[model samples]
Target chain A: MLINVPETVVADALRGMAAAHPELTVDVENRVIIRRDAPVPGKVALVSGGGSGHEPLHGGFVGPGMLAAACPGEVFTSPVPDQMVRAAAAVDSGAGVLFVVKNYTGDVLNFDMAAELAEDEGIQVAKVLVEDDVAVTDSLYTAGRRGTGGTLFVEKIAGAAAEEGQPLERVEAIARQVAGASRSFGVALGACTTPAKGSPTFDLPAGELELGVGIHGEPGRERRPMMTSGEIAEAAVDAVLTDLEPRNPVLVLVNGMGATPLLELYGFNGEVQRVLAERGVAVARVLVGNYVTSLDMAGASVTLCQVDEELLRLWDAPVRTPALRWGM
Target chain B: MLINVPETVVADALRGMAAAHPELTVDVENRVIIRRDAPVPGKVALVSGGGSGHEPLHGGFVGPGMLAAACPGEVFTSPVPDQMVRAAAAVDSGAGVLFVVKNYTGDVLNFDMAAELAEDEGIQVAKVLVEDDVAVTDSLYTAGRRGTGGTLFVEKIAGAAAEEGQPLERVEAIARQVAGASRSFGVALGACTTPAKGSPTFDLPAGELELGVGIHGEPGRERRPMMTSGEIAEAAVDAVLTDLEPRNPVLVLVNGMGATPLLELYGFNGEVQRVLAERGVAVARVLVGNYVTSLDMAGASVTLCQVDEELLRLWDAPVRTPALRWGM
Candidate 1:
């Protein structure tokens, strides 16, 4: 079971986050984390949120040059509109606020309602829906692809563009472009047990694999007996490559599904890189770790984001976040 | 079961790390990773190593300021003296080299042998033996406390001191103080599967935990029924607090086992913060994530390092490494 009190997980986690990172402000009552330097005049504010189970995602992502504010809900649940509305209003400058919405129905509905409410209250709100998972056309959770690790690419690229003092429209375009060019595929070695339900989210027998699995333990393409890591990495890379079809260099993120070891992820990364190189794809940049994760799920997802010069420049730009930081 | 071929896991993982991070050099022939600019004259180079399964430890730590070189052995096995000898020689600027070693018998023995070999070759070598685990006075695999997450502290703090161009003796002294002042304790919810063994190193019942567990899955203080996250955090904090009679601010690291989720670790961190606050310990700096981990083990370790201005300054100094980087 996930190591937490089922009743007070989100609020408790937010407290520790505030203690560890003094650079951010945690409004525990409203359950929103905002960068201390938020609401910079004339600069577009980037906001992201979803379930709280995915740590270092929307909340840990809040800092200078990244997400201005993050609204965290309960585990694998969406934050309410009030939290989002407050975060947007607090971080919104004269320029505007961009909501980086992941493409889950709950998140979309809440964010949409919040955006409308914010605008009515005189806050300019724009939204970019992140739905870059190519693993399934439809899954157990939603009608289309469920948002996955590629949302990190959208956040980072969009955050960088905003850091450049770009207008809200320009940052939204960059975020949408990155999200559009990204594709992710994952494999689950085992199921993760949510704390509320102290059991595996799904059942997969020993030595079996769930190819193209969703982040929140949604069903995947098919179940097959476990294969060698080389074979598994090849499958994930092949799925992502088919969707990408990029002739240019790409940024590769080999994200762990919470429970997997860093070594295994890196081992998987070697095979993915080999396969990509053989397929004539140059991985100019790579991130190998858990950025987005399913809670304690044993598996990994590979996200390939096709990057042009501008996207690559933004990707390489300095960012200072609790989770992902570089060159700052 | 660990997602790779059992025979070539360490070497293959190293290949991926080298590719993902081009800032360091991989001496595949020697199974050692060295900084490209190693052997900088008059600089006190630092070296660290142990088993290979623990990623981002020795290898991921080898970069500009952290580790000058990291030798990798087979899974859960100590690196040979030859590997350590080569690493120390390679990174020994005229100022000499310091090896940050865990307190494991194998690691201590190998590093000791390597120090002799390096000294025989006219390259002075010093070492800091980390024995910071405060869970027990003795453990299954060790005569005294077993070095765990505190090794990362010794490495980081010493690396920073070395980066300041301190003499070898000064750097070693700094490492020793950090190591001696640190205390760690871990609890394992499940066992980890070693690649070569292809099975769990130990067994835990459905709702039991191995408290005060070692990173290698060695037997701990005792087995007990699984408790709530708040209970677990409290137990761990109490253990560490008894070991560290802190009268000043501290550096805290709530490290995750390989398979634990970042969210749960942060959840645990919250309880830890509450416990620490109740105890009146001021946490000056904090880090929460998977730094030192057992391969695929579902657990977490809490390390508390009593720090003064000097140690805090060294920790805050610019460090450029694959595993840990901030303000660089």
Candidate 2:
């Protein structure tokens, strides 16, 4: 097990992120990472959050032109409505706030409660649920598609639209558009060890694969024997393609599951590209790294988002968050 | 063992990086990642090389404000002079070129030979040897203080200066200055698996630690039982402080040795800052994460560079590379 965390794991780690990045304002009491200068006038503020183990996701993503604020839950646990209420209230401009909710039951419930909480206090709130994981139709903790890597696309594209001074409806529409257009599939070599559990969430015998695993270590469809990188890429890419066939000018992301080294991730990206090319899907823009991850789980996920000129422009817009930044 | 890389791992991964980042042009035969707009006329080009597994290091680091070209050797092996010579020739814009050679023996020797070869070919070359790891006066792989994370500082500060149109001599001098002023210390909780070996680099019994571990899995000073995060922070901080006491403002980097999740790193960063605050060393700036890493080794290193305003300015300068980017 590779968890070497301290007491108050989530609090301590959040504090560390605040210390490293002065641009992020940490509300220790509320447990949110806020943009130092929030409530950008007339801009639809974006707020996202989930379990904390996925570093740079909800928290590392809190910055200008991306998330106005991020509410982080404990490792692999859903954020409470209190955090969402406070984050939405704190970042809300005159324009309504938008919550980019991932499609997990707990997350959806909490975000829904928080949206109501904000509206009750005379604050307008909207949400665009991201449920892009095509791995399982339903999982242990999710009612439908489990939100995975495609959340990043929603966050980035919607964040850019909001930053461009779009109204609340326009930003929410962008989020919905991207959320519906993207699809992802993941394969895990092993399970992640949560701090609370002190052991792997599940066990996989040697040379066994946990195909289509969830970000929170939820069980996938099968326990197949180990497959070559080529086979794994083919399986994942085929799954994504079967769900939604992206034409030319696709954006591909081969993301690592924490413990996988960049070398392995890059190699996986090559295999992914090879499979996509063989399938006649052109990868116009590519991103390979650990954007979304299960803590210390050695595996990767492939995300393909069908993008036209507008989506590409929004995706390529300047993003200065801690995790994903470019074209600034 | 976390590694599941493709055949010819380094070559395949380098190709993946080339595909993802169009700004970078990879010379497959030479195994070098080159900046598309190399040899910025009248500016000193920077070249760095090392083993492949410490990725993004001499490779992910090649971009506009970083190395003009990076020569990657086989996993955990020093790059040969042939790769470095070709890189130097390709990136040299007639103002001349500088090499950021790590202190490892093979790396040093290869870079030295490349410098000579480049000079023979009517190209001027200068070198700044990074010897920042203070864990040992001599190591299994090096004759002197072995270079570690401080090489990144040299590369960035030097890269910014070069991009600002600094001449070869000035860029080389800045690199040398940064290299001299930085000190690093790393501890490993486990060993890495090389692709060629297909197993761990070494064995560390459960709960036993490898203090002052090298990036390439060399033995350290001791193999003691596991220590608390606080204690680990204390030992690493004390070692760096004893080596070079930062008077007021200092830059602290809590670098993770691959495999360690971002949560653990952030928690470690918190511990480090707590220790520093206790000792009253003002942290002017901080950077945490895996910049240089051993492939999937679960551990971290603390690097402290006593910085003045100039160094801080150089450090904060805009860098747009695959691995590190900000302030653009």
Candidate 3:
């Protein structure tokens, strides 16, 4: 059943989340962050955001050890410059604030504009744009490749770097390195329903799946006949591995596209582990289930990160967001 | 794609859960719980259990402000006396242990047997049997009306009472009061696939929904033609409100049956709030989302509790479990 949702009501969902989780606060009027307690004067703050619908992403990732602020846009659309500007101002400490953005054209332009706005206010600002999705063929133009699953890994590792008191430049550099070292590929078993349209964002036959699909319900490189779980895992992981051929140990993520069950995710992860073992890939870390979702789409994505010693250390650090809390 | 799952793997799933959440230690060999520190010295411990397949119910609810141990059974099946006895021994402090049990025939019998075993060990024990589901008509003989959503509220309130260093008798009394004041009813939009069976646990046509469905995939009170979201919410909330007649301030939980999205749950909550407001029922707290799920069944349940001042305070207390954490 399709329900027509208003474009602006996307913020209502974010407000609902903020109301439910008091540990996090939102600027409903200005799209800023108030730190639940607001105005932490001494800490080096970090702010990040992009499109909405990849929930528990930037919003759920906001807390002590991760992002200090997240500016959200409409569904699958980049936040406007005003939102990022407010978010930057709200989380800026004397040390400086860093913005982690996905390398999409709209997001890059808006965040760049916001960075300028923050700089004009004498707030030291740095930006690290993630462009880790390997599915896009041409990197020279058209947003120069899109950011996808690797954004979370970058967020966690970079958040840890910042939490450890790294300088903004070093943290931004580390975030960029993580993004450069990661690759991802996804397959959509069914198209997602846009809240505004209530119908599917795209259409696929009952027996077919879209391979290498984008997170925004964007069309993939190809659509293929439905295959076994093992086959799907092979295609996704193989594509990622081919792009980032790292012999070093890696972190593997078998992420759900929102609507898939954890049970099925486990099955998909089992297939991933089996294939990686066959390829003699050394897996240093593994995370399964919904980390970044595309809003009720029946699909899964595989992410591989070529981890160095530094990356591994950052990955192991404590994180205390509403969604991904570990260690402390 | 019906996949046949082995029934024996249900226990394995529980073991996996214990492994996943280090906060709750599990005894795979004995199916028990000792603290991560292995046995708190002198506090009176609490243990609870019932059927499995209700992810994060008995298992997820086991934590600091909740049960000290939970004995999970086969999929939708009751745990044997041996499992419950082991759980009892592992959690038994010198002060004694309280068993918070739902009042199903199998659950009562098994817990009773376990209590007797504890008595033989010279370990003091008490039991609070919960029968809060209001859907069943014959509560006198027919399995005492089948415990449902109220199990969560009972556990939370009773857990708080126990945390306050109350004696076993008082804790049991509080639990019983919570059970008496709460009522719930649910509608299943679709059947869940049992992991072992690989197929759905029940059959429902595309347009039909089963009302008053049990947490363990038991047949609901009735199956009627599927209706709109407003209609379903009306039926579920009406059943609960009629049973409890909660004229006082209440906590309303619109819990997903497992697979329903937050989008639909929010719509359902809207209907629930609208109906309760029209009926002059004041809602003190509202919790919507998948709290107690039946694997991947697509449906939701409405639970309303008539809270006294004490109960309301307890409900507002801090909890730090993996599933439900707030005010902490």
Candidate 4:
């Protein structure tokens, strides 16, 4: 459904998130940070957020091990500067705060503005913009690339790095390195309904699926006839592999776009493993399921991250987010 | 798409699962137990299983705080007697093992046969059949109500009781308490496509949704006109409330039927909360997301557990399953 009530969407979503996760405390009045606990004194806090629909994204990912704060926006829309400023202030420790943002025009602009505002408050602030989606490379009238699935990996790896007492610059550099090594490509079998409008964002026929569809249900570069599970897996993995060139061992994520089945995801992951093995790429780690979703759209995305020894070790570090937690 | 390959479906799926969760081993050749660590030497082990399509249900739920073994069946079809026999043997400690069987006829019969077989080996065995779905009251035609979402809660709570060094009878009692106090009702917005069939299990209209649908995409108690989020929530919650008089604070689960969004689930949870409040029912805990699902059918289920102080404590205990983990 096309939900048009953009003004209250972010606030309402945040309220819902806070209610769902009692561990998270949201400053609903000011659209500030939602944290599991107050930032540790003298610790360089980490704050992140972007669009709303890709939930459990910045919000569910917020906790002790990951984000100190998350600022949510409307569905597929960027959060404004005020929300980011509030989030930054709420999470700023004496050591400083770092902003981890996706590479979107509105997100970059608003986060940049928030960083400046925080600087005015005598808080040291640094920003790292994630541009990892390989779907779009170059274009006028648009950002260079859209940040998609890789944001999760970067947030997690960087969050671990920060938790280990890394400085803001070092954390930002590690996050950028993680982002640079990751690439994702997705396909949509159907369009999602924006909650307010109560209608689908786009029309897709029963037998047709879009290749390389954006998370916002935006048109992909190609619309092809429906293919078998293996064919679709081949297409998606090929796109991600060609873009990322994972000649070494890599962490693979076969993520569902909201409405796909875990069965299908596993099936797709099997195909991905086969294809990667055939191409002589070792699968070091694999995560298959709904990590980052685009509402209830029937689709899936493949993400590949080439990992050196250090990257793999960082990936193995304990993470304790509500969505992804292991080891510790 | 429907995929028919009855003979290989379960094994293939298990292979994929083992690959995805390297921490858990899948005995594809023998349908045995999966343990993160070696089974306790003298403890009464617990093993469970049924149909395979319920990803993360009995399988994803196997870990530290849950099952010692899970026997998977073909897609939506129950496993054969031999599979259960092997499962029972694999996890049998010197003390014995408990079989947590769902209420389906195939599951009960096969598990019963397995129990008999295990008895032949002089192995102590106990079985607790779970029938917590409130959709059906009569067990004449279908061996009673089909076990649904309540199985997870029962298993977790019972597993906790077992982990606490409770005897077989005590663990069984706790499992029965969970089953007796819990009730679930599901609605399917669309039919699930069996991988083998490549077509939906059943047809659904564009705007209509089926209420009380089964996990295997079985026809629900009713297929009604599509309504607002509030209306659907009211209907689901009403069904659960009517089935059980939950006086104490209750744990409510708003579960997606594979294809629904967390946004809609949260919206439904809000409506459910409002309805329960109108009825003076207090919600002690709430979990919203795709916990148990039927492939990619767009729908949801609501589960209510009447919790007392003990059950609440059990619910609060740490669980380390792949799907539901908290506290720890």
Candidate number with greatest DockQ: 1
Best by lDDT: 1
Q: Count residue pairs with overlapping backbones in model 3.
A: 2
Off by over 4 Å in 4: A1-13, A29-33, A138-142, B2-9, B30-33, B138-141
Error of 3 at B174 (Å): 2.7
**Native-to-model Cα distance after best TM-score fit, residue A35 in candidate 4, in Å:** 1.5
- lDDT tens readout by residue for model 3, A1-328: 2111454445445544544455778666665544564346566677888766776677778876678888877767888988877877777777788888888788888889989998998889888877777777543323666788898888889888878878788888888888889899988877776667766788877668888788877777889887767788788888888888888998887777866655355456667777888888998887765677776677889889989999999998887776677666
Docking quality class, candidate 3: incorrect
Query: How does model 2 score by TM-score?
Result: 0.98
Stronger candidate by TM-score (1 vs 3): 1
lDDT on C-alpha atoms for all candidate structures: 0.87, 0.85, 0.74, 0.77
Best by TM-score: 1
State every prediction's TM-score relative to the real structure.
0.98, 0.98, 0.81, 0.93
Judge candidate 1 against the unseen true structure and give its global Cα lDDT, from 0 to 1. 0.87
The pairs that clash in candidate 3 are B3-B198, B5-B196
Interface RMSD score of each model: 1.6, 2.4, 4.8, 3.4
For model 2, how does the per-residue alpha-carbon lDDT over A1-328 read when each residue is reduced to its tens digit? 3234534888878778878888778987679889988988889999999988888687877777789999989888899999999998889987989999998899999999999999999888999999999988788889999999998888888999999999998999889989988999888887787878776788977578888888887888788988877788988999999999776478888988888889878877878888888999877799998889888888899999988888899888998878888766
Regions of model 2 farther than 4 Å from truth: A1-7, B1-7
TM-scores of chain A, one for each prediction: 0.98, 0.97, 0.94, 0.93
The candidate, 2 or 3, that scores higher on DockQ is 2
iRMSD computed for candidate 1:
1.6
**Second chain TM-score, each model:** 0.98, 0.97, 0.92, 0.94
Clashes of each: 0, 0, 2, 16
